[model samples]
Target: MSARSVEVRLVKSGRTKIRYGAELLADDGVRLTVRAPWAGEGGRDFGFVRFEPGDVFTEHYWRDRWYSVKEVRTGDGMLKGWYCDVNRPVAFSGGELTAEDLDLDLWVSHDGATVLRLDEDEFAASGLAERDPEAAEQAVQALDELELMARLGKLTDLLA
Candidate 1:
């Protein structure tokens, strides 16, 4: 199929957190891949990593998976790292893809030496455990699985 523009909407607590346009790269029944530019304004420096303009994101989302993996790269095609988000399985309809963020994330650095689990405090504060224990547990499991893959230098397998 020819490339098409798609909007990616990230939802949290029944609200849209962020939305951006991307180019649909591929779709294989269960998985969808898209290419997008960094959606944040200016740059964000988290001490351990920085996301800026000119960065590219090759994002993969699965219909049967609890998480999405994004390969981040510099403008010149240099590898930066992978950013994984624990979320509900993605849904695509009306030319848009939507995912409900679970407030949990994993960041794997370029060399796979710095794997960080992020937003645990937020996840705890979100009260997901009280509201939906099963989803909360699945989110945690997804984060753990991503971390293990990063440490084992197998994170790319998901992208493949």
Candidate 2:
């Protein structure tokens, strides 16, 4: 409604497992912005990077099938690059909202130049194709669309 505090969960598809959680900062029904502590954990090995526990992230989530974009910033408000997760449409229920991280990701640089795609191999190895081919195909399409948006620099407005 009016940017009330809510719990946001990133849950695995068709399961009760929660991969991540954050505090919802704003919600206009169609889109939600959330803030959470930045844990320097990702699928890839990018060496050592320093992020304080209270380093805030403002993540934007759409009700549609677009990927969620997280604008990372330091605790003192320094800019960090965006980390986006390609996933299915978000679902909100009760006091919580959830999204399925499709295992495909796109990282856009702070200046929005260097867009890197991540976790294709992990997506392929996730057995989603064997479990649910149609959903897996949709995930691929979502990834393609998000990649194009990142390349065209259309994702910057999403954070604002």
Candidate 3:
């Protein structure tokens, strides 16, 4: 293997088993490597990516973030995740992100989702204006972490 490449091992047998090298098929029928950089190395916390039932996974992180997609009772669909990479924006092909230009701005096309960046002032002035000051006020406070993520670049791209 190359210096940056690692071999993935198929621990369990199911639909996502592999007969070849370390590569294996995932429950979603997508082939993924168990050897992500986050999987620990040499007994140290290099990094680890482990997948399990219901489309869930336990992935360790290094310099980057981790995410997964799962299909449960309703059938496995893509899952989203975000960690320490808060400084950067996100994108998604599941939402068909945006235009494809020659620029380095590749946040779009990430799951084909369009995202609007909201400044702090804009967010303060934004939201529905209603007569019920309490309700409006509550709405503003209700803007939890998820809502804040929407205001960033493109968050939809972190799909499983």
The best candidate by lDDT is 1
What is the C-alpha RMSD, rounded to one decimal, of candidate 3? 17.7
Better of 1 and 3 by TM-score: 1
- For 20-114, candidate 3 gives per-residue lDDT tens digits of 22212222222232222232223322132223333332221111212121111111444322221111111222311111111111111223243
- Compared with the true structure, the alpha-carbon lDDT of candidate 3 equals 0.26
Tens-digit lDDT string for candidate 1 (89-121): 999988799999999999988988999999999
Candidate 2: stretches off by over 4 Å: 1-3, 13-21, 39-52
TM-scores across all candidates?
A: 0.97, 0.81, 0.18
Which window of ten consecutive residues has the lowest lDDT sum in model 1?
A: 1-10
Q: Which pairs clash in the backbone of model 1?
A: none
Summarize candidate 2's per-residue lDDT along 1-160 as a digit string, tens digits: 3345566677665675554456777778888887777644633334323455666788888887647888877778887677888777888877677888888887777777778888899999999999989878988887787778778888776667
- Which is the leading candidate under TM-score? 1
Return the TM-score for candidate 3, rounded to 2 decimals: 0.18
TM-score (C-alpha, index-matched) for candidate 1: 0.97
